[model samples]
Target chain A: MSMPEGRMDEQTIAMRVAREFQDGMIVNLGGGIPSLACNFVAEGREVFFHTENGALGYGGTASLEEADWDLFNASFQPVTPLPGMSFFSHDEAFAMIRGGHIDISVLGAFEVSEKGDLANWAIGNMKDYNGDVVAWIKTGRFPPAIGGAMDLAAGAKRIIVAMTHTTRDGSPKVVKKCKYEITARKCVSLIVTDMAVIEVTSEGLVLKEVAPGLTPDDIQAVTEPKLIVADDLKEVEL
Target chain B: MNKVVASAREALADIFDGAVILCGGFGCVGGMPSTLLRALSELQVKNLTLVGNAPALGLEAQKTAARTMQVPESYADGSLLLKNGQVRKLIASVPAMAIYRLQEPFPIVKALQEGQDIEIELVPQGTLAERIRAARAGIPAFYTGTGTGTLLEKDKEVRQIDGRPYLLEYALKADFALIWAYQADRYGNLIYKGTSRTFNATMAGAAAVTVAEVGGVVEPGELDPEIIVTPGMYVDRVVVRQGETG
Candidate 1:
């Protein structure tokens, strides 16, 4: 099988995920690629961004000259505040997440199971090592930082995972079951990856859109489980 | 009725060995009581158990972004305590050494690598905040579905609530709470600037002694009652930062 060509880059993947945003939606964008989605929200559509660190209705990343260490996003990047922006305590911020107030949460993942389980926090045998720091470091594995991913996964009304289809070594990231530490169980609703746009449904993983020039078979080759191709499956639109 | 202290060192003067201190902040120095942490370091108090969001990126790691960001030269965090071998354990959500300068050598990681007896308990960010808030609100325990199926659920009590599984978490309390705020009244009413509020607001009154490091202090009635994020009653002491007017 020939390797698929013209895979979407991080910016393109974020752009595709941004299309899922609706006006006036309160969205929480996790670090890494998910953070880029804020830059691609359609013009005229108003989306309020929430950070777990305690700020809502913030604008995009601030320029160096305008940077304020106190004003930052969940990614720890300085951001500009918008009119009507409000700050709250960490408890209040997480209350918005756990109380079913956030409209959408877009997050990056290490592994996403076919059943929509998320495993983005830890890797390798770090979970079972039992705090043997010397041995753990010798294995070159740093302790995983859970952050707010689990709370966002379990509480956000809808979860959209944005990641590459495969790891750098061509290993599948969309798998039958997550081998890494699970962040949350069966929480993902939509997945926008570099290779395809997939949806987690009651039936199974549905292939909704493939990157341009890639076929359903091409996507399936890199995925772990069999995919249910959508009837209206089409090329990913930027 | 005045709660104002002259300096950070005086604010934390009562901290002793083996005390459990809650340091409030998210990831950056903006939300942290940097001056207090520095004082704690200078005091050389040992065996402290720290509770917060991250383990705190030390001054060296922060220096990388100091050039482009709004970081202050006097910035410090719990890392100062860790570097001084003062912390015995840390309970936090994100325990990573340095988020930006990943390659930098962190004292906590170095101590761990050398097999120093430092313990770290990882909690989800929301759960951590809720736990601290619960302590302040006088709630002993609560059920939440945040860490039901993860490693964090190990040895925890789990119950089915509304057909969903939840882990029972006890309220986390501390001996002292070190926090940062934008302004304070002589009576200790606090108002924070921007996102710097983070854990600071939630941690007030959550500990035996809640100390606030503020940019400035105003007359008791000078601050409008409506805008105060933390009531004066929750704060035990308020310390003005150096070179700032009261």
Candidate 2:
């Protein structure tokens, strides 16, 4: 099949990533891409949602007026609660995450190394930028809101990263080594991006599938490290 | 005889300057004893150290006669305490989300930017909860690997257990704990509604004084004896919001 003409949109990326979610899995969705993925969870799958903010069995996003400010997800978005839902304290919730009870954790990232080092929390060099200088002048550094990403990244049984393939300026997000701060080391299992699907393995980033309309060279040109095409590279079904 | 108070102000009457308060809430939503927070804001007591999940807590939204527009009026969370210069320090996880450049500033973010006499210690969300629970459980300290190699573990004790590093975290106690509950009986047993129970259930006896601001209050035998999450001994005071004076 010929590669698609352009990159996949946000929703498409989310949908592709959501397809990986399995039934009966207790999943934690991080902010941004991971948060949007919940909308695309396959029907008939009894996947239970876990929010690090201490809620389980979370439902869809609620409309503003229908929002019970009390009912919210980890992203702070108003959400519905399915029946048989339960709540717990922070300690118990983290115990669940750190104890390796969470089956899958989908997170967004600024950069991912071939070895699977993840960095998404802070964007260093803000103080050097002209617009951000005034605000960060006194502290000389911006505080990265790490939240619960590290715990989820390190503790989830398997980690899948859902993000755009490239930055707005066309720089590749998948690199040989992340230049930014590392959130966790060697935690990623699969990476579903707008351009391609890759698996993080001991052999390096192995390309599993290319988004429609793209070729091996098309993905290679944008990727920083060398790419290893799988024996049977397929098109990522949206 | 019951522990129910007529006003939030009365329940919090003994709070003094420089007190450590554990305010329950997750991003201004659940487990928030907002009525008591508003009263505390009005009291304007200074130098409080707040420990909780999120930063902001909101009060009742003010509506005009036509109810066309509503404006949030008071400090129902740590932001108000920070705004009033009442907070000397804050210990929390997910205190505020200031992820991007163009996002509008949350009060806690603004306060930090202005360089007030405030201190913030950002704990990993799970670790924060565990520390608070540890206090209530009477466990002095515990070890976990959540932040072992990250910035959060800098200058902290790190030990290797089963070849994995775990950071030593101390229990987090407070002078007072202010929490919200959906229902309470005259004996101070609390029953919470949905997400509102988040941290309130665990923080019940983690402090010297535990005050509950409940939506409804009933007689002693009204609540189901089998499912009471927090027994009356944990809660020192119960402020019934519906019958309370502002």
Candidate 3:
């Protein structure tokens, strides 16, 4: 398999995820790639942005000069509340999620299995680690955050995972089965990566679309599990 | 009868050493009782157990470690309290993200790393909220499937509900709850502004005494009943915004 000349950027992944959102839908954006989707929401589309921090109908990031410390998104970064936005308590916020009021939730993942099992929480137990000590000390054992991702995964009507195709060491993230602790089993519906767009189905992982300038073989070489190619495979549209 | 206090210092006067406090906030922003935290820092009480979202943004630790970045104003809720070494234990969800690790670890994580006296018990965000809500609602314990196969489920009772596993969580009641609101009346009824209502509303009545710091305080009849999110019965005292008239 040859290396592809073109790879989708973070903005492109966000744009692709943004395309899945529809008008008037209550969309929850997790940190990282999902959070970037806020900037790409289609103009004139009435997608209500819900922050797990107990707010709905909020706008995008605020300018530094205009930053109101009280107005922020779930990422703990400052945000601007749009007109007619409402606030609730954390209890009520999760109630809205568990009650199925949230139409869709976009989250970042570390590993997604063929069965759509998510293992983004803590990478396998750190006690078994035999890696560099200083690097381990700097990186720490557990991922620094897992705020409300599990609740969102269990509750959202639909879950879209956004992540890079591989780790920094070029290891595959899409695997036969997640070796880490599973956050939710068989919960992911769609995945938008920097390399390709894939769908998690009951049958197995299906190749939906490849990034521009990349061939199916390039993606297949990195993907640990066998990917079933869609009959109408095409380039991912932004 | 005016239940209004003059300042956050007076509002938190009864807080003793080792007292458990339920704080209300989302991140460094949104619904934090900023004044109360400042007062708590000045009071210098030790061994306090704080329950909240991100009590502090943990930015100062980063600034000290990096020496390159400027530390922003610690306007968030419990930054002062932690900076002053007040917290003994913290029951919170994820306090900070991966970005905070770039320079210095978040205060809580740093404390845990250094083997300090501080302890942290991580809770799922929803379960934490529901536990507090259950206390306010007079519910002793409830079952949820949130932490079922995770490390959080250790020692927690797991029951099968409709063949699905659900972990049992008990109510979380504190000695005092410090929260912020957009507006409050002399009767202590509160109305919160956009995004600032995060954990403030749920924690209102979950403690033995609930103190509210509001942007403004009005007469009883001034606030619309329909818009009041927390009733006066739940709030023990209300303090108008410090250094400003409402």
Q: Best by DockQ, which number? A: 1
- How would you encode candidate 2's per-residue C-alpha lDDT over A198-232 as one tens digit per residue? 99999989999888788989999999999999999
- Candidate 2 on B216-237: residue-level lDDT in tens? 8988888988878789989989
Report model 2's TM-score to 2 decimal places.
Answer: 0.88
TM-score of each: 0.95, 0.88, 0.89
Candidate 1, pairs of clashing residues:
none
Per residue, candidate 1 scores C-alpha lDDT tens digits across A1-238 of 2224759888899999999999999999998899998888898899999999998899887888888877888787788889989999999999999998999999999999999999987775454677443345333355567899999999999999999999989999999999888999999999999899999999999999999889999999999999999999999987
Superposed by TM-score, candidate 3 places the C-alpha of residue A24 at a distance from the truth, in angstroms, of 2.9
* Per-residue accuracy of model 1 over B1-246 as CA lDDT, tens digit each: 899988888888889999999898786667778778888899968999989997465766666655566456777788878777788987887766323555655656766665667777878999999999999999999998898787777789999988999999999989999988999998889999888999999999999999998888888888888899999999999987753211
lDDT tens per residue, model 3, B129-178: 99999999999999987766665566899999899888889999789998
lDDT at B140 for candidate 2?
95
lDDT of each: 0.85, 0.77, 0.78
State in Å the error of residue A39, model 2. 2.4
Q: Which stretches of candidate 2 lie over 4 Å from their true place?
A: A1-5, A64-66, A125-143, B57-75, B99-104, B242-246
Error of 3 at B162 (Å): 3.4
Which prediction has the highest TM-score against the true structure? 1
